[model samples]
Target: MRISDIPVPDTTAARGALALATEYQTPALTAHALRSWLWAEAFALVDGVTGVDRELLYVSAVLHDIGTVTEFDNHSLSYEHAGGHVGIALTAGAGWARERRHRVLDVIVRHNWPSVDPSMDAEGHLLETATALDISGSRPGDLPEVFVREVLAAHPRGALAAEFGACVVDQASRKPDTAARRLVDGGVVAKLAANPLELL
Candidate 1:
């Protein structure tokens, strides 16, 4: 079940996405973004999914957690919303058309949703599923051990759980009405603590 390779798109948007992630995100968070994209690629390979825009998915994955970064954390906006806007700006600067740029925003925002219908947005579905696998260990057995190992070897989870846990906790404390609060209340910390990827 392991994919032999996890492709990284070589395009203006993809390059800008990684650069922005590296500049704004901690090394751990940047790795999480990279891992998220790797996971998305794995899913696409295994599931034989087609018609996804690779550049858009890659950019969205790189920027999905951007709101957790300090420079972008000053707003009262929920992290997903803030991250989505950052995605919008990045896509715009990459010369993406407005329609495709909005897809970047949509994908980033929906990645945090509990479920995303693939028929509605294939990239969003892949990202939501990928981030869920990375963050909370959802669908734990769906990804093969070999694939997971390859991704970890490339990215090394590092302190992603601790750093992201703290960031979400802080967001929850400040924005009680947001999904961060819901996730904290729903035991995301414990899930992070128990994530098999961390143990892997």
Candidate 2:
């Protein structure tokens, strides 16, 4: 796996999140998670976003999509909520305090939100914006084009657009009132297909 120049935050909690994602998530999903973290870091730097809990954001990045994977998929709950629960369990295993664990859960769940206020939760804001960039190429100009190509070269999209889209469509089919449904109704799958990042 070629890694980009971006230095992923390495901490015990971050490592744990990576391990869990690698073990349980599909390769496409894993790469998306990793890229999400990279995008989060890059966005933070470019936007002068400071004082964020880097480890928390990284952990949320890697764990954010695991719920969509087969083993962790919750039939009833939306993928983000299920993933949030998984994040809480994983962080609790790492001995995080209640507040920290809650933060992980909130970040994971809110990453799918329409928008997150940076002032209220910097980590959530970063994760939400980061995922948007990766999944739909939102705010593409925020990071340098060269840096984006470097990241894509390291963690190629593979079948992420197809894989994630199919999973989300299925989720929407089953859970009509979820964010997944909203995303589907809102043409998210089409946006994924046409994501400029993939074209790059």
Candidate 3:
């Protein structure tokens, strides 16, 4: 669906998170983040998943890559961990309860995990799947053509594969023990080569 047609949570904290995320991320990364949320929402609807806090999901998605930004990047921590910490700091100002704040953090940190069982945590699972779809073009056929078209039309993946790959490669270069390093060492090049958008 078009970004304007997608359902974003209408909350002050959610709005604030979006604004902050936009300010922190590059245009391509910001589009990736926004598309990630839309893909997650689409999957959730298709799977009949319920009880998901869309606001929490939105916040988590937007902030998921904050650690990659220069200001939030931590030399000592994985980007996921750094992003989670940054998310917590940002949400704390929104006056979220401690438990709710932690929940958002959990979603951010786990979104980059190699795998997640959707039955275990809906938000985390969806985010993981959505990110994979966006970055690797892993399962685009699972989503409807119209929906995919609208999302890409709104948030065009202008060199996203190259840009995102460079981001991950840069992270790997700087942090030897990071998941990004593992991904690169674990055939991420082939995966990116297989990305459907590469042909475009």
Candidate 4:
């Protein structure tokens, strides 16, 4: 689903988030493309998530990387952490319900994978997997093979997830860091840019 389809408390909030994300400059075109792609994925996934709080996931995913857009350096975990507080304010401003807001906040706060609760799997699992797929890159070797196979390929959610993951990596690879890091702008953008078809 598109952001327009979602009932935001304030239409401007979504626009504002886009404005905020675009306010930075990265050395990579793929970085910018990745960010744009992930935002689209978040919207798509929100519409597709079942038995889950769509509003909460949507907001959390959309605002998951507000901080990283400015000075991303492959250090997305910190951005995920920093996004916690900002996500709350944005979600509330966007007019998500109170309980839903809290749920979104919880997802943002714990979205960091491997460092947080590896065992406490929840809806955030989808978020984590989606994010990872993007970071892993398009070439398959660029990203975790398991992510592409399990979350992006095997699962129904993987259709969007995998496509977005491969797209971001291929785009981001257009500009490789000095060390061949192939830095994607931020975690959020990197994930959204994962569409392999774009490369094909």
Candidate 5:
């Protein structure tokens, strides 16, 4: 479903998400863009795997990290609670169907357990990989080769995580040259300051 058609989460939930992102030191712009793109990607994958509604899946993915904004330590539990909160708020505001709400919660809850759960769907797998990649930065010197060679190479989830992490870092930096510059400058401050929109 189109993003426009999806109902926005409540003000409190949105603020909570932003707060959690700040606490986690999530780059504001990156998180905003990443959430949108990630949801779109997750929806596509989920739709392909299950006959579930893409819009519902997108909603779940977009708000999955809300509890992270709170004090939730376990991502899986945080996601589940966040999903419930969003679902309840959406139901009240948009009059969503019970089945659709359940679907959204199921997807959100499964998203944080890709590595440990064999029953994860494509959307869940994609979300897990994308989140891992974001947490593991992609700058030139930031690439953990040992993780790739020794850890991820044997695991599908791990390997995909590394690949997506690299791609996200590359995309975030604009180019390999930019990555080199970022490494030299000690961070992406200069490059990003020069081209703010590039990050989005």
Candidate 6:
């Protein structure tokens, strides 16, 4: 489904989460986050994945990279780790039960991984795949061209490539043991080079 067609939940907590993400994240990251959620939702609709908690998915998508913001990057934690913590904290105030809150945390933490088995959690799996498609341009055929065009038209990529690359490189430099560093050492550059997307 197109993002315009899918209604984002109108809960007060959802609004607060979006505002917080907008306040902290860079413009590129904000756009990426929204696009990630849209891509995930689109894939889910095509695949007939059901029972997704739309609010949690939206919040998780928006806050997935929150740790990249300087205010949240005070420690040596990987951006994913920090982002997961932030997600938990943000949802805790929303009065979610412990189990539901942790599910959101799982989505944020697992999104950085190379793959997410759908059996684990449909939302996380969708978010992970969507992130990969957005960043590495993997599985371009999985999404319709019209949907892709609509998404990009709504949220232009602009400097997302350079901005995201620099963020990951900087994280790798700061914390060699981080996933960012591992990805870099494991040939992320080569992967990006092979990506068909015109990231520039």
Q: lDDT winner between 2 and 6, please give it.
A: 2
Q: lDDT values of the candidates?
A: 0.87, 0.88, 0.83, 0.45, 0.42, 0.82
lDDT tens per residue, model 5, 31-148? 5423433433533443354543445544555555543333432333333455456545654455566765665566555554524232445445445444434432322122234433
Ten contiguous residues with the weakest lDDT in model 6:
191-200
Show model 5 residue runs off by greater than 4 Å.
1-33, 39-52, 71-79, 116-122, 136-200
All predictions: root-mean-square deviation over Cα? 1.5, 2.1, 1.8, 10.1, 14.2, 1.9
lDDT of model 1 at position 184 = 96
Off by over 4 Å in 3: 1-5, 197-200
What global local distance difference test value does model 1 have? 0.87
**CA deviation > 4 Å runs, candidate 1:** 1-4
Give RMSD (Å) of candidate 6 vs. truth.
1.9
Pairs with steric clashes in candidate 6: none
Q: Which portions of model 6 miss their true places by more than 4 Å?
A: 189-195
Q: 1-200, model 2: which lDDT tens digit per residue? A: 12345556766777888998999988999999989988988888888888988888889999998888888889899999999888888888888899989898899999989999988888999999999988887998878887888888878989999999999999999889889998998888998998889888
The model with the greater lDDT, 4 or 6, is 6
> Residues 40-134, candidate 3, lDDT per residue (tens digit)?
99888777777888888999998888888899899889888898887777778888888888888789878888877877788998899888888
Model 1 Cα lDDT, one tens digit per residue, 13-106? 8898898899989999999998998888778877777899988889999999998888887468889888889888877888989999999879
Q: List candidate 2 segments past 4 Å from native.
A: 1-6
lDDT score of residue 194 within candidate 4: 51
Error of 1 at 68 (Å): 1.0
Worst 10 contiguous positions by lDDT, candidate 2 = 1-10
**Per-residue lDDT of model 4, residues 54-164, tens digit only:** 445555666665534444423433444555556666667878677756665567655545323324534465455544444443233443343334333221332444443
Range of the 10 consecutive residues with the lowest summed lDDT in candidate 4: 25-34
Model 6, 85-126: lDDT tens digits are 887887888887889888877998888887888877888988
**Cα TM-score of candidate 4:** 0.46
Q: Find the number of clashing residue pairs for candidate 2.
A: 0
